[model samples]
Target: MLGLWIAVIALVGPFAAKLADVQHDKVTDYLPASADSTQVAKIEEKLPGGETTEMVLVYHRDGGLSAVDWETAAGQVAEITRQHELIGGAPKGIPSKDGTTLMYPVASNEPGANEEQRDKLVNDVREVAQGEGGLSVDVGGTGALATDSGAVYDSLGGPLLYTTVAVVAVLLILIYRSPVLWLVPLVVAGIADYMSMGVAYGLNQAFGTTVSGQSSGVMTILVFGAGTDYALLLVSRYREELRRIERPYEAMVAALRGCGPAVLASSGTVAAGLLCLLAADLNSSRGMGPLGTIGVLCALIAMLTLLPAILVLVGRRVFWPLVPAFGSTPKQRRSLFSAMGSSAGRRPLTVLASGAVLLGALALGSLNLPGPLKQEDSFVNKPEAVVAMETLAKAYPGRGSQPIDVITPQGRADETLAAVLGTPGVDSAEKGRTGDGWTEISVFAKSAPQSAGETATIKSLRDELKGSYVGGDSAQQIDLEVTNARDTKIVVPLVLVSVMLILIGLLRSLVAPLLLVVAVVAVWGASLGIGGLVFEPLVGLKGTDPGLGLLSFVFLVALGVDYGIFLMHRMREESLAGAEPATAALTALRTTGGVIASAGLVLAATFAVLTNMGLVQLVQLGFVIAVGVLLDTFLVRTYLVTSASVALGRKVWWPGVLSREPGPAEPAGSSGPAEPPRQPESLRAP
Candidate 1:
């Protein structure tokens, strides 16, 4: 099924992209009025003090800033100001202050300009800036960011295909140690990727869903990451089976049957978590939720259907080098899983306490970390914008302002704001336009955005201005940031509650759910603390994109919890066999610990590559998520898995609904107390 699905998808995937590409907006319509908006309207609106509005322009010159270069920079500023379409110019700079090579501000020609116009206008400015010189100049920021981003998105498809093929080839080389062994997983994963792409593209085309550059690359990465993971688990057991059974097909079937359920549940849980992102208010964010869900879902479907069929067809060659051992089943007792389990079980409290303290300390930094979604640093110091900014800043203290436009629909002009121009909090206020008798006033902030201080004040100022001027029939609108953050944080407990409830039903335990989320929460705090540590030293484009921190919190809290589920499920199985609490705890660690660790390592590393992306948001996002996953898998999960088991003891499988029936007596390991019980079908030797 995986192979066939791939075949069908590969045949049609391009057609799907082509159809969806038709909706691509070269020209944007009115302001976005609905959640379903998929065009240039996705471009953020610029308010007087609203978020993501200002552009950072970098200046370049030969051999740094000389007297002549400063003069040239001033000339460049004059050149930019000549374009009268936009209401203003990016202010000039003072290179003497703080090594700010060049800086200033520029905005759209029309206030109501949609995303398409803004993007084209900015790109045109960049082109115009570039045309003036011999210097190598590049323009960035949200305006240029999206334009550059689109090209990057188109490039990902080809690279992703290459990456998928490369990953399979590499995995086969390392694990099988022979090029011949590469063909099986390569073909299987390739098919899965192909099939998954078709579904993703089909959905996008049908729904006008937009897949950005980061998401595009991520889809490929996940397919490779997960496909390789599933293959590894299956192949390890398959090799074990081949040594015991002469019938290769039967051996393969047994391995598949054993690993099948775990794979399904793991994939399902990941997909479910990702789907929750759809609740985000941003269309760009909401659009991604479904793509991630579909990719994981496809991987799950492929593992269940197509992989089995392929294994059946391939026969003995799947384990060609190793001859089949006859008569006896491969040894199963005293496995590596039992070793780790027993060790952790012995020191459960120590391990659990240590992990809790470590994560708690990391959580403290997150509380104080500042900044919101302002893209100042994202501006790639292009020579024209930078020089232009430098000239203005040098000449005027606050000319290059990040303005907040407050529109009041009423009989009065925005004279209240006009009256507050000399007020303390404000650097300056200028009366803007009047539409439908509604007056617009612009407020210029004196301070650079820092954490929530300026953000909160700006919000307050906007509110006061609105209250002072708004009439009975006139309404006030503020466009700062509509984050799902606060609401999401509040509902997180609810989401965890919902997840806990599901676990209770699955594992038939109430206490088990709390332990899992607690372990998950521990990892979440640690991730945030670590993110602050990483950012404390980074003095680049990372600071400009505020969504980076938010993404870290989201990814770490959600995806990092997955291994907990996998670990706990195995623990419950081991405990029901009438093993003592310590014994059962050790058993789960021995088996699930090693595999979960490897999975986490791969997952963390995979996300780490996101840091290499050209985009700042993706880079920050990639690093933080990658670290969180590693911490969860290695630091938190390793300790908590055994600790929770020992702590819960008999109630690990509470309600006794999933209790095991009696089986043949088995001996305990002398190395340590074994979680004594005959193997259940789920973890049994064939």
Candidate 2:
């Protein structure tokens, strides 16, 4: 399949030029207002303060931009604002608050316009500023900022790119210690990623699916880590076979025969686990199910097909100076692998018990985690929207903040507000009272909605709006700015649950499938709790984009479960070999432990890079997943499984067929002894 893919690409490269336009960007990617965010609809809705397209604000003073200069700047701003027809057209004027700095508001006439609008807007600005005296302007806003974020990869991302690639490559080379063997997986994985992402884009186009910008980073981690993992499984088996088999093609066959089932099973479970992400209600969260699964599947297919074919084609040279360490004669059972098996065959209890307690304890945190799903919550630091919103809040009639639209047919806006203000738990309402004819009263409270007092006030307001006004609270818009955010929380959880059930069926597991879900939830909760504890008192813990919560949980559980499945299945395999359950678990841990650790670290670092990105949601997600992968890979995989295996011992299987009988007959021509080892240290399994 991989060969066919490479061949197809080669064959189609030239023809595609004549076929139809091949886009570098996905159709979904080009959607107006960013289809990836759930907030789009809400943001697009008409509310107070008016929605404005993002515009860059550039002003200089003094020794920079001056007041007289700013007056000219303001004049220039007004002129541009008048001439332009953009969402946030040229600033009406540069307001000089300090008399030294200029404040110009740039508007895009077309808020959701395409590249054409951006180009015209840019050119328009340049024309207007042909030669303004002592006036300097640098465009900066959503359009500019998003461009800058992407450009981060284009510029400083160079070192980051090299670092990521080189780290993975270097690690692979070190582990495999065979340059020729090392390079094979990298190339195949790269090709797989390209095909998968491209196909995913195509699928999204056909289905109207949307993906977050961070999807790219996740894809990168999946391709590198999962790709290398698959390749490691295949090549390691191939090497093991070479020692026993003389012929190159024959060795390849033997390798596949010996290890193919495990690889398939391993990759299958990982893919199945990730497929659970379809349960995510958030577009940003659930979209990864297919995106990541496809890449992993493609890599698996490559490992199965391209790797073997290439090895056969390359003959003996695949190992280079390593030569064929494997020979014609059947080789001795590996002391390490065999010893591991034997020890696991002995005492499995200790191993399983220790590991289980640790993971379960960590899993506790997930239960209390808040379900955050909206795109707006991720803003930790103050942003233009926030600052402007705060400024407006301070300036509005009810302190110039968000207005609650009370739908009561009976009362005036001012009277209703006054009534609500007088109600219990109400700190203060900035509005005087409900005004004549207006049932909805804009009320400003002393506290932010995030504060308990505010929430309590909102509840009181709702009650008043329901009882005090002619209409009920549901029908009327309360001046409360938080209703939609609360509504989002309600919706996102149902989505996550749906996605999880779908995943459970795909993974074919009951005992531990939920563990991944639990793990993800725990990590998410812990991160938020910790983040809140640290940030809440400092600047008031800003809730992250609710999408980040779902996104983190989805990815952590989906990807985190993948690691779990790999270890669990391997532990099961060892147990079946007659090692006591505890020992088998340890054996599984030891063999898979290094790979899990390495994979997690690489992925965690990749995600951490997003924290440096300075986006609220991105940083929140980075923190959550970074904590999650660490906990999952190290604590759960290494610590928990070992303990569970030990504690369960022989009965871990219960009434299962395996527990009822002696282990199956050792395969013919096998070197494992009929007798199990007494000591636990000797047991190990992958």
Candidate 3:
């Protein structure tokens, strides 16, 4: 198995390096294909100019602009025009009413729709449009914003990977308390990540899957986070099995047999939940589904095959100072989980009620979450484009600084321009780039971009334009908000039902699946509630990512159920072995709780790395998932689920064979004596 994996790695390693080359972060790549913004983008690409790159140069001063400042702005604009082949002739400066700011709109067809060309054009323009003294100059517009956002996304590759690996390694060292044991799984996870990348690249080639920076970054996160999780479960079980079995190879087999089903089921749930994203209208969301599945499956394969082969070859010495000698029993001492299970078993109702109420209260914080994030506020740090937009918002109050694109048939171009000019909130309208049976009309709103008034104006245009397509940076944001809402409605229910069905099939019990589903759903709500409380007041974020609700809900519900499966699967195994319901519940918690906690910490820590990312959406996603995983691990799984199981006894598995009383004859497949096995000393409550 090890030899085969090494050969496979050799075959696929080169493709992994090529994955980033195929990734795109264009605005249209993320938009819904059916949206007007998306249609406008596609149609413009077919027009004569082939989708022009647009930018705005802002020159501002706290004091009124002097004659020198005016000449400096004109000279800079002229220099930019001289340096680059702009679509229109030289740009004309539009001075602010306050006489403190001058703005120039620059458009160029040379770059067309090529991102690299556009980035180069924007950078070249920036070099000439430098600010000196009290005069502040910034390059801001859709093209510049895309470039800034793309740079941040591009940087996410190396830093994000290294940080995640470092975080997981530290957590593993702490969990194992061994010098060498942590390295094996981490290396295996890295290998799995490499394999996943190659497969992702292949998927893109074979199916034309849209690979965006956001989706690719998420794929890497899943490869490390979920991959490490499977490794922890397998390693813990192998350590336990080594104490009973004489040989390392046999012990590894025993561990795989014992824990493999639960791992498979958990990973399956996550894959299914992610696959539900395919139903979404947004291109990014749909693309994420397949790439994420590839990550999980690759992780699953490596942990199951390569990890076991390596451990078997290394033998018991791989465990170092804490090696599990043959036929040796671990020291018997009461653990934290034993005490927790005891408390839950003693007062299950009170514990369950308290947890539910706490979750309910936290969920109310979602109501306090800020509105949809604006493009200017999307970055964690203010780039030149965002700064320029901020300056424009202040200096050009009550007028739009960004152009609103309206694509219409050539025959209707005149009528559309007239209607756009007559629109109540349109500050100005002009026809541009007539070709290929389409005419592009640039409309500037009477209000600031992405503001409530501008949003209203966009909706009004869509209503009046009929055959015309209205789109731009602000229009794309509107489309994103609307599409995310639509996806949430469609995808959330699908995830819930899909995950629940998987749980039911795995557990073979209606009640148990329902309980696990409810717990995870509650975790999702509480985590988002926490984000609502912290995002604006603490993080200084102005608004939430529109996709946060849908994405977080899917991740929490899917990944959060993983710990529950570990605990409940053990519980079911114990019950099937003829242990009484209460004993089985407590024993399951006592035996599996520590490993589950360790896995949870590793997963949460890996995702928490995203909180430090530069994008607001990534920060929000990482925070919510990390918090939700921790809650599910420490609170819901440890306290509430265990308490409920103890409270309900056998009925937690209602309608399943285990729910009934064992007959006088020995329980089928019982390895121990007919009577229940004696409780272990380590599991005893102090």
Candidate 4:
């Protein structure tokens, strides 16, 4: 197995480093597939020089722009046009009503659809449009915003990977408390991540799945988080087996025999849940499903196969100062979970009721979450584009600085242009390039872009102009909001149903799966609620990402149930081995609680690394999922589920065979000296 993994790593490892090179950060890559904005983007790419880069160079002063500012703006605009291949003629400057600002509309196809080239163009323009003294120069438009967003996405590659690895390494070192033990899982996880990247890139190439910075970044997180989780469960069990069995190979086989089913079930549930994302309308979300599933599956295969092989080869001494000596028993002590079990056992109903109420209260915070995030507010730090947009919002007031693209049939170009001009809120309309049976027309709204009035105008144009598609950054945002609503209605139930079915199959009971599903759903709501409380008030974020709720719900429900599976599976093992239901619950908690807690912390911390990313969406998704995992790990799995099982006793198993027949219980009047309480049969090495 070691030789096999070494060969696999050698062959596939290089692909991981290449994932970032193919990752696309285009706006259309994330948009809904059938939305007007998507169509517009597709058509734009087919045009003469491909998509045009449209931006505004704004020159301003506190009091009023001097004559020199106008000349500077004109000269810079002329220089930009001379250097680049602009679709339209050299742009003319428009003076603000207050006479304090001069804006020049610039359009160029030099950069075309290449995001890097487009950003370079924007940066070059900014360099030439620089302002000093009393003058202020800012570049604002859809092209500039795209450039800024690309920069943020580009930053995700190295920093996110490094941070996640560092975080996982630290957590593993702390959990294992051994220099050698920490390196094994971390290295294995890295290999799994590399394998996942190769598969993801292949998926993207063959299936044309959208490979965005967000999706790929998420894929890496899942690999590390889920991979380490499986490692934790296996290593913990392996440690226990080493004490019983003399040979490392036999011990590993036994360890896999014990924890393998639960790990498989857990990773399977997560993968199945994520695969439900394929039903989503949004391209990015849909693509994430496959990529995330790949990560989990790869991680699962590695941890189950390569991890065990390597650990077996390393032998028990790899545990260093705390080696599990052969034939030795684990030290007995009062554990934290033992205390928690006592409280839970004393008053299960009270504990369950209080937890439910607390969750309910936390769920209320969802009401306070900000509205859909605007393009200008999508970053944690204001990018140049966001800053430019903000400057335009203040200086231009009622005027929109960005153009609304209307793609019309070439035969109806003039008629479409007339209709666009006739739209209620249109400030201006002009003919653009024509190609492939279609013509592009630029429409400017009287209101600021993405404002209520501009949105109304877009709606009006779409309604009035038959065979025309209205799209721009503002229109894209509107489409994103609408499409996300539609996708939520379709995807949410599918996710719930899929996860429930997986749980039912794994647990082989109706009630337990339902209980887990309900618990995770509550965690999702509470996590979002927590985000609502902190995002705006504490983090100073203006709005939530449009897809945050849906993505978070899917992740929380799927990944959150992982620890539940670990706990319940152990309990089921105990119940099947003749332990009474209450005893099984308590024993499972005592044996598995610490491992589950450590796994949860590692998973949560890996996700929390996303919070440090530049994009607000990544941060929001990370925060909510991290919070949900922690909540599920510490409160729901440790306390609530255990309490409920104890409270319900045999009924926790329900229609399963273990629940139907009476478990092995102490007989009355059996007063002989008790043998050392028999260990659960499942825990013994086969």
Per lDDT, the best of the predicted structures is: 3
Better of 2 and 3 by TM-score: 3
Reference-based lDDT, each prediction: 0.55, 0.51, 0.90, 0.86
Q: Candidate 4: where is the Cα deviation over 4 Å?
A: 111-113, 661-678, 681-686
Residues 236-353 of candidate 2: C-alpha lDDT, one tens digit per residue:
6576666667788898887686556556655665566556655544344456667777767877777788878877778777777666565544333454433543444354455445
By TM-score, how accurate is candidate 1? 0.75
Q: Write the per-residue lDDT of candidate 1 for residues 1-686, one digit (tens) a residue.
A: 54666576668667545533432322121111231111112222333221222344455554445555556656655676675344454565634344435544554435445545555666666655541344334453334544554454455467545744664566456556554555776676666666666677777767866565555566666776666666666666666666666776787777777666666656655665556655555444455567667766766666666666676577656555643455655445776546555666777778777767878899886664444434333333323333443443443353333454445544555457654564445667665544444455556656433324344445556456643331100011112133434436543554465566556655667777677767776776777666666654553443524445444554565566567766666666565555556666666666666566666665666676666554556666767677788877766776665676787666656556433333345322222354545663233211
Model 3: how far residue 561 lies from native, Å = 0.8
Q: All candidates: CA RMSD in angstroms? A: 6.9, 8.8, 2.4, 3.1
Q: Candidate 2: lDDT over CA atoms?
A: 0.51
Residue 357, candidate 1: C-alpha displacement in angstroms: 2.8
Give lDDT: candidate 1, residue 588. Answer: 60
Can you list the residue pairs that collide in candidate 4? none
